[model samples]
Target chain A: MSIKGTDYYTIDELMAVCMARTIKNGDTIFNGVAVPLPFTAIMLAFKTHAPESIFWSGLLAGLNPDPPFLPPTSGDSVMLHRANPILHLHQIFDLAMRGELDRIFFSGAQIDKYGNLNNTLIGTLDNIKIKLPGGAGSSHIGCFAKNYTIWSIRHDAKVSSKGQRVFTFVESVDFVTTVGRRTSTRNRDELGLMGGGPDCVVTNLCTFDFDPLTDVMRLKTLHPGVTVEEVLENTGFEPVLSDTIVETPPPTKEEIALIREIDPMNTRKVGFSRSALEKRYDF
Target chain B: MGIHSSKDKVCSLSKAVSRIEDGSIIAVGGNLSAREPMAIIREMIRQGKCNMHSIGGAHGVDIDLLCAGGVLRRVQNSYVGFEADFGLAPNYRRMVQQKKVIPKDTDCVAVLMQLRASVYGLPFMPMKLVTGTNILDLHPEYIVMTCPYTGEKLSLLPAVKPDWAIIHAHKSDPKGNIKLHPPYFADLLAIEASQNSIVSVEEIVSEEEMDKIGATVPYYEVTAVVELPFGAHPTSCYPDYTYDRKHLAEYVKLANRGEDVFRKEYLEKYVFGVKSHDEYLELVGGHDALEELTKWNQGTEKWCELLGRNL
Candidate 1:
């Protein structure tokens, strides 16, 4: 499944890049509460390339649920496997530490250059308005996986434009799912690229990845029918752009089929972006 | 008393299966695949266990074998596997295709909520989660339940209260007070929902040690606890044992491939020949009698293989 040209990508398409580019076959991936990264990894692992990827989720089973892949949390029942989870959620730390995992799909309310993720405490701890989902297992596993793929659908002017994200009510969250940098911590070597941090951000409009050196997360590509300027206008953070910036690849018929056709339990609805999101394509 | 004699032990897995009559609600613990007591589950299928309503936990070999073999008539909660290789359980898909098993879909909280309510003795748990989305809406039976107190628009979710609760344990006393660390709560709740609970334990402690142990333990909750060493080898219970990957990988291949292999390999290899839990342990080891797992490898190697492929 290959995307073709210079265009903005859909959330699903960008999610594919997050799955494929960040993770390869057999990589043990840790998924946060609600992420498409592990979903993409598992689907691609099953259908296309990686046939033996290790998946970890919040669900106690640590196995992927059957079909059409609608994961509510990284550990939703969908990820459980009656036959094999290698280990369940209880064994996540053991496996990750042993270098058994290669990738992780996480959500960070705030992220920095070093790939440190903050999924909780957006504002001050004492007086909190919007209390996001408490960190299920994101804190420890986020830095442990080989590739950390971060995603959030609500990247618009309100959350993104500010130095600190304000929730539906937050003053500022200090971390994010993936920022473009590496940390000095020697504990996490499984994650490839030393730090291809945040590998990709799957938004309503496009998919994003950052430069290896500059530590700047730039708009990697736009979804079909979306312009570079359109992505920037909607983007909350200043992104690194190349003059010949490529357009986001289009979703393949097969990729489309994998998503549209055998969607697990018909859970894959046309997921909506944030209220602030302005996508170029209807999908 | 000795922790485990390794002799005169009854076949706990088979014993557990014997209690589960057809169509009875069975609550099986172990997350997704890990910590699941496959030995007992396989015995049920090999014995041609059928028409049973399987409840609780995530997808793992037990659900796979049952669904693939047509033993399961209905499936509640999540399963098949989280993702990656073999994506989902083939047998479950086939069951869905043949329209044999009913799929009860739910979110993590929903599944937890259902189980949580079941154990709590609440008639039903109220959820703010919008039901119009996905599998949550698929099974109105599981998603909605009437609040016994309110008598209002409470969605009636079935009490996961099972007829028998079968679980794999690391260590427990003969009296059935168990000690487990992180993964303890899920199993503890399972016991609360079921009428009678069976525990296949790794070590059966004396009253002294068992009394000294303090964890999630309720004497009233347990019915039977068998001391079966290496019982949860491949599946961890923490502070007690680590995952045995090789054994689990073998199960995964069979489960993903469907029931034929499961019947041949797992049922034949582990279940049929063993007369009891001690007999099964003897099957893994020999006359020397006792065997201890030092480190698990099959899983790490396979994980390496998976990591390489993902990279």
Candidate 2:
């Protein structure tokens, strides 16, 4: 596989920029804890394309944080320093229920082929081997927010595999912590859920969108240097491939600089450092 | 009617927390890392309150320490862990994983709605947030109701009026009226939704000052009021001080290492060892940290300047 901008940018920066462009102007985004990538991406988008965007900072109940330095975690109290009209966590959730929020960032340890997320347990409820953190607000945010997006840092055979915990993209999720495209409108109506299911799934290697008809996750774009064959090999479940798969746009210098500005502490970039990447995949 | 004397409501932390009986549902106030009634929580542990049901809006050290101290039998809240780099709430995680305490998972909205239902004297609060989520199935208590007017279906969270509610605030009057600086998470609702409410504040002000600050929770609703400075220590008392990151990090590390170690050393050293909040404060770096933290309590102008918001 051939790649571009190796010297200029890292894969994580490219992914952040790619995700950042999806944020439309004036969109209100709700981000949860441990959200370095989405936090930086939203900040980058706000600084560039979407200046009017409001970040519902759940960490400190902050609104539109204009912090001097990005805190390491979304839960950091420093996020409240520059916030205006500081909000309550419930107030942020109230915005979601009121259809005021445009998008929410959600993730799970396991994602099924149909975009269903499982974060409750890796094994049976009675007996659990690996108990992932329960859905903090993703369960509601996934259905209330106009749309939600899921991103993954470790995209490997085990993470993207088809079995239980052994393979993440299972035939059926252990638990549907977050509603996704798999639940049709009729089903959602029965459950009294509004809003569309997950619209996008961004990862280190590729980006996926729901199929128009089937609502299954389909390949939308691949990061530079990655291939369809590699994605297939890594995924546990079969994914629909686009006929003309486009390369994910590399982060421009300006966007990169803005991301750096938002994250002067280098929290997001540190995860994508060469040594970190090498340790992750043993490359 | 005009405000009356609030002398009877004032009490010590021990007296405030004594209202909490064993096996009672106790609602706590605070966001993830802000305004948690740590002094009250510590007192509860000191008093040997065990097997109490814990419910709150967003809980962190308060609930985690209670779980670690073997005080909580079950925890019902949206989330219970320390956020971001602080990682999981160790004792909460260990207990839940070990099934020592039942974990009743709910969202932040659902928890508030439940409290709202109680506050409004309603059986349930209609919400759209929990719809189509696994919580409905996991907890069958959440019912789906149809809006009589619009005929639209919505999720109904049952009213959760806990037996006792404990909260921390910046200031309060003897009448139990509390004043919060800003980002008053769900403290008011929590206090209102409980059978009895105990409030710990940094200072006791005159009723005029309480009214000036807009005391949200009226005196009639308060069961007890205690003046305890730095009531929210490990977690923040927003506008007063940010969370003690190093202390919280140490807790997460010790709690994660093993429950035995947590129970033996961490618990012994920080909680059981120190007889009071002042002792705990002194042990954790004393008046120097408090003096430094006092700068944050003044106002947001300095906070904004530190953040470089103008630029």
Candidate 3:
């Protein structure tokens, strides 16, 4: 719960910083609807490390919008405040098809070891227990974008309404809303997916990267104060772990300040649960 | 589909919507919350339009309200929720869960490709993505095949020709020359691909004025035009007004309370109770509240305040 000798920050801030760090300068990045965390991270990257990166607003279809403040909704007109050369929906898709899209960020209800995502449903298709808002473009973006990052605010296992233990990180997602490195039968290469699948997964508990050889998720770094045992216990499937499991780097003072500036109203925190919002870090 | 070349295509809101029969596939324009043809949608509900198949890219209250009103039998949409403002759409989720409505959930690109097939007058369109995902399984209309030219696997999406495409725009001529501002999210596609297109505009201008503004959707493509100011209310119509967040919040709250409460309180009070769009506007808050939404043009502070952001 506490990390000694570190600057004060919230878990949301830390996760945002970690995700922002993945964006390289000049990379064309896009985030899906309702993704406040990635939105904050992209803006943070613009203000800090990757100012040259292109921010293609998903729902708004704006390119590199300079909004006064982070709006609660992604498709709000505020996103198009100073956005120039606004693109049509087809144009954005054309970019993805032409292999011009560099990066994309998305999240799902369930993620398997291979990084396949399921935002469609929980139980079987016929006997549906829970129906999620359908994946808008995650299926296409996951397959087309040069690389994508899967992020989540929830990391732990919880009991479903049906009294079944539900793990966010599952062995196999109930439905594949977005394909990752490998499916039940074939790998990404064999499946002819243009994108490199998910490069990394940033979560409240830890960060994971797919193993190059096996195409399975591997523990890359643990969030500060998150124990390795805690992550292993929470994950539904066993993930490959490095011999030296390092702590995820906390956001620098400047990065935290930039995040605060970009999201003055703490719009980034809107996606987090009330209890998760209360989880604060201190030196 | 024949071109609608009539000089004056303007008609009453009810008349415009009446062209769309029950069990018709309707493609509602707008992405998520902005620029949704809410007034027309309200009219459809009031007229008791039912068993309609709905299609869109991203949507919130508009489609959710349609589900709430028992207006749809199937939804071929990419998303249907209130982004981060609220969480999942209550009525939509409830209906889909109970199997009252079929969830033919689609990807945005997939919808675009399918609609493009219709626009291009093709039987089906070949797509590279979505081959590995389970969305193909959900959409049996999508056929997986090896490309003859490249020998690459591709998913062929059947043309999705909606019966009507409903849109709300900034301005229009009497002949239905629609002009919209930036962030035209697939509205043009929806209009072009559908068998018939209906548009409601905030203002009705002359042909000269429309020419000066540059029509986004020409009169030939449009079947009917209705001059319904603030037609995209509750959602947004851009420069004219922003989304009524407080009103939408109230809607979400009522919708979340379940079917009975939503039907009685939200639907009855706002939708069924109002005789017309003006009545609905008056019920929401009248001129004073609408003026407040237009304050986004004043400055960033006012804009932030409008969005309920405290900085």
Best candidate, TM-score: 3
Q: What TM value does the first chain of each candidate achieve?
A: 0.71, 0.88, 0.94
Q: For each candidate, give the interface RMSD after superposing the true interface residues on Cα.
A: 15.8, 3.9, 1.3
Q: What interface root-mean-square deviation (Å) does model 3 yield?
A: 1.3
- Give the distance in Å from residue A218's predicted Cα in candidate 2 to where it truly belongs: 1.0
Question: Can you give the lDDT of residue B84 in candidate 3?
Answer: 68
By lDDT, the candidates rank as: 3, 2, 1
TM-score of decoy 3: 0.96
Global lDDT scores for all candidate models = 0.52, 0.74, 0.86
The total of clashing pairs for model 3 equals: 1
Whose lDDT is higher: candidate 2's or candidate 3's? 3
Cα error of candidate 3 at position B244, Å:
1.0
| C-alpha TM-scores of all predictions | 0.52, 0.88, 0.96
Q: Per-residue alpha-carbon lDDT of model 1 for B115-234, expressed as tens digits?
A: 667777787766422221223234557544445686433334555667777788767765667776444426766777677777777677776896787645565577666666666544
What DockQ does model 1 achieve? 0.04
lDDT of 3 by residue, B144-261 (tens): 7988999988878899899999999888899888898878888999999999988999999999998887988788999998999888989877888888888888888888898999
lDDT of 2 by residue, B39-76 (tens): 89888988899988877655678888999888999887
